[model samples]
Target: MSHDNKTAAYFGARDLPDVIDYVGEFGAELVTFLPFVYWLYRAGQLGDRKVSTYRGMRPLYFFLSDDQLIEKDEPRRFVGYQKRTDPSIWGFIPNPNELIATRNAYEAFPNYRKQFQSTRFSFDKPLLVVHNKFNREWNSDTPVNFFSIDQLEQMFSRLKGYYQIVYLRHGRSGSVDGYSPDHNSLIDFDETSVMQRHPEVIDFEQHHREYGGGVAINQYKNELYAACHHFISVQGGGAHQCALFSGSLLLILHKRGPEAVHAYSNGFYQYATNPAPVCMIAFNDRQLQDGLGAFTDASLCQGRVMLGANGSRIANDLAPSRVQRKGQPVFGTDRTPEPGDVGVHF
Candidate 1:
């Protein structure tokens, strides 16, 4: 059988294009398909089998290549897949039953954290990687799932003292191949004023422009992320990328999307990292503020590291709660909790 046929057999399907079409969204690929592919490669089921992916995503597949699963680096193609609307097609399999059973199974796979880790970008203080993007989604007039200028300022003010902040906002020119067209159109923001107001926060794009040394941008980002341990990112590919690194705290400001069910209920973010980073999902500005406050307070009160039940160093005072349990709230209160409450999954 041909490679395509073999892949179909392995996946228990016959149509490669249909599978690809079904798993069309960029985030879905990262959260599901890529991990499944990595799992297969690690299981020694795909010896010397080549995989094809979009150009900027090669760094994500580096673990497979480095492990000699593929004889040569996988072919990187341009992105032009069909758009998928149904959230049921969000995992490795198109069948929801199989997806439910196997959605979180990738957590058991080998950690991709250690494979791409680097210490080249160490800083004087603990690194705080902040990624934001302004783009239209769901035909909205303004961008959804983005940090406003006010929000960015608030976050910088709250966390700058404790961290060497690195701000990343790759506008139109930096949009990757597989991302939706809506993601490519840049919404206007006063990034200049934000940077000027917060001189302490490093503009990652400027730093990359000066020091990237003609390296592939994705690879450069992977190296930078590998060295850092804390991240605050808006929802999208950037948040997913930050979650790939182990032993970190990722606070994602996500207002609405199909990702909510997966990230919160299914515990998908836990498998994104090996030991699993402290993943916090903030649904709105208020929740984001509260989550940041919790971290800042933890930082000031107990220093940087506190031991978890697993003996891993986690944020002090932020006790591990059953936030991933469906219908549970992260922060308990007297009255009924409003929608979009913060949810933190260890």
Candidate 2:
């Protein structure tokens, strides 16, 4: 099977575009989302809001303190979501396999493995499931090695009217002080260094510092997650965590406005056939103005359409075949793509 045909699945409104495209580009299928709060707990951060629960049972994963995730352990018990049963929203499907995981059977089973792992083995299938975590601690690395303007445009179009954008400025340049008198930070960041590189953005350090501690910053972020339609950033790890907290989208600057097409490699978007429609907007140059210019194009407005001549067709062109073993889906059915396919691996 070609790389683009793999199915990748995930849940939650936060960075859903990032997760979908990240996986979709690499041939992944989005199976279902484990509850969002579970991600917050895993990332070791707090969120502003709680997600609605379904069927009284929520999916979760356990990550070790060392940053390695404990793959698919047994599900854990939790207090009910704000409302126990609400109408299901549009997104990834909850694991149908887990529907068979009733409380009695869940507890009765001697070795309870997370449904994420065992379901595939049941039929010798290769379904890749991912848990999207949006905490700042994990934000240091860029998700994709390269961001194409076409891909960015597609993503922005999806989130266009869907979000109210916000731009945050770090006060000074130097290692960001996690705590300070007039200086502050959540992680080690040098606002001065960043500003030295790009001074066009506005900064409000004194104003921010007066408020005191990470609490002030946390409170502001909580309010942003709670109040804003969405937050746009050159980069935003908080956006990831906030999605679980606020159920909002996180618009990231993937490619510059002036640049047209760029390269993309392994990440969540690379794993799936069709990820949720949300995505980062592709722009001509990295500059915001240039990016906004590209976004203004009517064709680009939809956000679902990728702009590249090649990258655009990669998903639709690469369809995996469906074969059933005992009526279950398996990957072997997909035929390899011809050399002319959009994302034919070199």
Candidate 3:
């Protein structure tokens, strides 16, 4: 820590989502004349001080929006990353007790809650995204975050003509209620199958190049999400990222109750500062059954959709009334409502 004047000390790494969160902090730095700001880079994702690695940091400086960077000094540093605690510039850190967290560490940062998105990736076809997150066998303590392949297929069948059900493949696997994503089956996405590509799916690198490049992978990922019309996923990281960056309507399924979700501060707005519309579907009992709950502010309830598990109508039936109210569309009426595709905060 004593010798190198060039290398800056970045705190968070290992987790890709959190790392991207740190990258978002760079925006606050760019707008201000703070001389120099600490750049966060994961352990192997950077280079030695002697060698200025242009490739890794190039995309960031190139693609960042005017609002993303806080007015600060201009110097690139490759600080190391770790997985213990995340600290935002303004100090809005997460409660140490929760095991799973999003950009909560960067919550206090100025641009921390803002969504950095690009529209170049959106398709002309109606888009629907499914971000499945199931717990691995060893990690069964948490509830399942994925849907059965058959369930997904059913969803596709209903939405095929109206919407393209896009499945996200991060080369992951897990089980739920004796069911898991199948490698042999054409529908599942595993490490091996991930390489085999699909016509309907959107891959990050390929799409980025199509849009004229010059951006980091995380920025590209946000671009991919930004292009979509709606996102449906269990309550987890994918849902969190989608809410923050994708600009898609969120349709989330959460198993945890209001008490636990409240205690953990799992609202989507805590992470996504975007003033976009949001609506969450809770699967817990004893909650308000038919009423709606808005994330961020209650007045921004135009497209505010919320329904309890037991007595609520299916998302489709409620879309018209839930998504639009008093002649106003939540995020505009450019896209149609695909139930199971809603929004979140936290």
Candidate 4:
């Protein structure tokens, strides 16, 4: 969880380690799994980079030669994905047609793979500055994850209020009902969207959208990441960093829990170095009926914020321009971890 660990520092191209920690040196490589089924759709709409690298960190130099570039790269190599770097003792599980989705992701939209060249997108000119009030609720909410909102609430009530529930997010809009605007992804649900009776629930996402205006969702999320009790890395794109930096919990809910199905992600979740409060629960009833015991209970989801911060969710380190133009907060803060909330997940 040491974000500034010099043990894996980049010495330079000439001094690279033969098999150093690739994932640690550059965390964005985890998003390589963008499925092809939604390629052009994501590009045309959100203009989302295929990879999900954090804002300031430079990417690692991919040593892949032309020969190694496309030798069937695993989906987990992408920024949005977490990969299993080692061989799995568990036998393979099938993803059926989903393999086509992974293939299409690489072949159709290849910007993420371009990391061997450019560090990030470059603006030919200064970015166009437009200041206006932006608003949307639950637009960027991710529909899939380790547990349903109902499932999470149930678990929290049973667990003696393990953690509070504040939701972080990215671009969302009217298009995010059952599917995103272009239909590349399902709707990203607001953490409180499904909460009807939980008085302890705090939805900074909803308030931020209505009253806490900002230029972009990431700007708000940066603040949320800063302002939370614990930035639990749950089921979506916007919250990746909390798990990486602050060392919170990880809850991975998958429909197909087969160790082989999406093996790289399961491997990543299974082997993540971050301490406990992390759990991987596959809700595959089919797998369950077959004597598969790979499921965790809904009561194990403990990474939500119980109350909302009184102010903005924008992080302080925002570029000066973003601070001025976006109308977001200068910084966010994280409270000390409570007793049960702190640990490495075994």
Worst 10 residues of 4 by lDDT: 125-134
lDDT of each: 0.57, 0.26, 0.36, 0.27
Candidate 3 local distance difference test against the native = 0.36
Better of 1 and 3 by TM-score: 1
Worst-scoring 10-residue span by lDDT in model 1? 76-85
Q: Could you give candidate 4's per-residue lDDT for residues 48-157 as a string of tens digits? A: 22222222222211222222222212122221111222212101111112211132212122222122222221222211110111122123343333444555454435
Clashes counted in candidate 4 amount to: 38
Clashing pairs in 1: none
TM-score of each: 0.70, 0.29, 0.44, 0.34
Better of 2 and 3 by TM-score: 3
Q: Which regions in candidate 2 have their CA more than 4 angstroms from the true location?
A: 1-173, 178-206, 212-216, 235-239, 242-250, 255-278, 283-346
Highest TM-score, which number?
Answer: 1
Model 1, position 93: C-alpha lDDT score? 33
Model 1: lDDT of residue 327: 64
The root-mean-square deviation over C-alpha atoms between each candidate and the true structure, in angstroms, is 8.0, 18.1, 14.5, 19.3
Q: Where is model 1 more than 4 Å wrong at Cα?
A: 1-23, 64-110, 172-184, 298-346
Following a full C-alpha superposition, what root-mean-square deviation does model 3 have from the true structure?
14.5
TM-score between model 2 and native? 0.29
Model 1 has an lDDT value of: 0.57
Writing each residue's lDDT as its tens digit, candidate 1 over 47-120 gives 55555444456566776554332222233222222212222343223222211223443323335556656666
Model 2: which ten-residue window has the lowest total lDDT? 21-30
